[model samples]
Target: MKQDDTTEGAAESTDAFGGLTPAEGLELLRVGELTVQGRLAAASNATLYCTVSDGLRSAACVYKPVAGERPLWDFPDGTLAGREVGAYAVSEALGWGTVPPTVHRDGPFGEGMVQLWVHGDETVDLVALARETDNEALRRMAVFDAVVNNSDRKIGHLLPTASGHLYGCDHGVSFAEEYKLRTVLWQWQGMPLTDDALTRLAALRARLADSADPLRQELDRHLTGPEVFAVRSRVDLLLRHRVHPYPSPDWPAVPWPPV
Candidate 1:
């Protein structure tokens, strides 16, 4: 992990995690002991801020216990934690670090989703960033949200790090069977897919087509059969259209409390 000079209102610097590699970070998160530090009172669910340690290594993380999830009418099949993990799987498979390193594990509360904490660059205006059309990372994230059918891509979920990397969180309501991509990132809507996006989607489509693909297997572990299938279907649709999806006329184009 690397540290940035600007850390005024940031949660914790990236270097606070002890310069762990992605594999090491994931391993620590998967096996380390969790100690609750405090609760994120702003979240709708029971989002706990904690430190995960395996004695030798440790990092700050957010823990969302399945037992603490608030039920939603639209997504009733699986636990929100599972959906969070599923969303991480999609992001990772695309080779996009849009979502932080997240895993499903047992914690003090119960089985839930645990993700590496990101300290966003507080200097960036999220509202302005969400509406930017020239950002490559944001464009990739928009495609990702479309694939996952993310229903809650609030401006607050955008985690623009001081290191210039962008990540998103609160994916508990994603992977719905219906087309419910309500996001503030519609800047690329109806535009031709970027060359990078086209290539990545093509690769993702092939991987999802294979049942033995690890990505598909991981998705199955969290999402239902239909939900997983819906993911593949969504990817196929994107590749077929070769363009950014338009906001659905039926569903609200953006989430409530956009920030």
Candidate 2:
């Protein structure tokens, strides 16, 4: 699958797995201002860093194909372009400090996921960051992610900013109502959820119909109904039960390509 970059919105560029190029595939990135620095990692698929123009701003970007391009167990459609964008959308709203603002860019050259460039150090885990928080916001990030039905969040996806803040990446496989809660963030696997976190879960459930909802389109048909309910229940569970991180074994052990 190939990727494309379009300053125009991706309204016309929608497709199964966001419609990668038939031939050029990875090479279609020549039109962008950002140059391919290097291959970050190659597990689920591929990832690369490049320059991108979002709205009126320009910044470095991580580019990669939508889920349909790669074959991981989590994404049944093999593509969750809509869902990945949804996760980023919600993350940005709450100032989660985890997901950077993301957009779906496409054009004559390439098409796929394009997100704001996050310039910072990639260190620190949720547990280490959780220690410093009084409200336990660190632990809540995991619960919030799970409530959103994040399907893939290995250790490496969580990064530390130079300022000591924690950030999350690689949520393309999120928002499925089933057993998609898989991550290494559950150090205290059986911990209870805080009141504030519970509220956010309700907010997310209420916002499930958000016309701008990113996951609404990408969420699988098999999971469409339950997935929406899952979002509601996951929020309730985090609010009611002390849901800890479950074992993410069948989950892919490799890092998602950082494109």
Candidate 3:
């Protein structure tokens, strides 16, 4: 994977939110004209660089239309966009701002997922930072991945912003009912969860338990009932154990092209 450190063009990049908050970004994505800027060649599905504008405000974002999705034997077809939005909902519900603001809406290509693009700062070495097992943000990401059963949490997905915050993306393969938590961030394997982490997990468990939880309701739109149930189960299991999970011997612990 190529290392992206070019802050010089960030002013013109898609993530240039122009001081817009995440909530505002979501609204822009909903109402803005989604003009395709380019295609992201590395993704298996058709991922595009797009801009959304409402005549007054505009923002750069990534767009993944459901029609462009390739079939996966493991995951049901045409649901990748929903899973992406579901991941964002789960992230916000946990109060972990790990995912950039994302929404599922009608786009230039049809129904798809539009996300506020996150431009990572080239200054921070993400690989080096991942090795630091005690990094709070990474730790929370690990927990978030575990809850979502993220199957692709490669180093490239971990974006470090100029503000010193880390944001993760490419969650189309998450929320699997099966055990498929593949990621490169296993630095804290077997370590006990911090008090703060435990507190967050408890809070998340309670939220998921609510029958009318907005996040769960949103997730139901994209995920199968069993998949959503599995997410709650993972939270319960994590809260019960209170430790970082070890990799399974049956499956690959980390993604290929680790960076």
Candidate 4:
């Protein structure tokens, strides 16, 4: 990941809140001035710090261009941006709001995925939090990772804000047709899902059942037909089992540099 010099300019004068709500942020990303500030070093792929503004309001976001994506043996290149958007769509469809607002648009580096930059408490240790059984959000996220076939779920990817809301990011490798659910959240393994979790799973399964559903249509743009079918199959399997899945013995159970 290469860093670019910060673009010079002040935020537009519009909203009182220097930050934007998820809905507003999405619009801004669609038609706004995207200025690349720098590169995020923690990411393996090219992730840029960007500010999007429509001259009335401005929002801080991360931009990941498909052109800069590193080739992976299992996942196809140039699909990461679309996957990111698909993850956000799934999160919204479930009404979980676990993923920060994201959109696919043309950026400084061409078409890419732009997501609202979440400000979280760095003091919080996600690894330790993942171990605690009390965090229901983390548990839901784990289930979500399973449904999406997330290949990466590092501790650092879990962001907890001061308001106690948790958000997950870096979902470019998700929604694969294969069983690649590797993550640090295994504390709930073998445990039965809560009634609420089951309800949400049922809702997601129902939405995906309709070929013309908005969520399915949105995901169809990002994933292949078979890949989308796999997501529905995973949801069905989870509903049938109603228990947290155990790690697969054939593949590495957790991500590297878990934190």
- Candidate 2 regions off by >4 Å? 1-38, 41-43, 54-57, 93-95, 107-109, 122-137, 209-225, 242-259
What clash pairs does model 3 have?
none
Q: What's the lDDT for all of these models?
A: 0.84, 0.52, 0.83, 0.82
The alpha-carbon RMSD values of the candidates against the true structure, listed in the order shown, are 4.4, 10.4, 4.8, 7.3
Tell me the tens digit of each residue's lDDT in model 1 across 23-67.
Answer: 677889999999999999999899999999999888889999988
Supply candidate 3's per-residue lDDT for 99: 85
Of 2 and 3, the candidate ahead on TM-score is 3
**What is candidate 2's local distance difference test score?**
0.52
Candidate 2 has a TM-score of 0.65
Per-prediction TM-score to the true structure, in the order listed: 0.92, 0.65, 0.91, 0.91
* TM match of model 4 to true structure: 0.91
lDDT of 4 by residue, 28-84 (tens): 778888999999987889999988888888878899999889999988878999999
Winner on lDDT between 1 and 2 is 1
Q: For model 3, how does the per-residue alpha-carbon lDDT over 1-259 read when each residue is reduced to its tens digit? A: 2222332232233432546767788788888889999999999899999988999988889999999999999999999999999999888877767788899998878999999877667777778877776567778889889999999999889887665566799999999988898999998888898787788788887877786988768988889989888998998888888898888887899998887
Residue pairs with colliding backbones in model 1 are: 1-19
- Give the per-residue lDDT digits (tens) of candidate 2, residues 144-193: 57767675766556554443444567777787655656555556566666
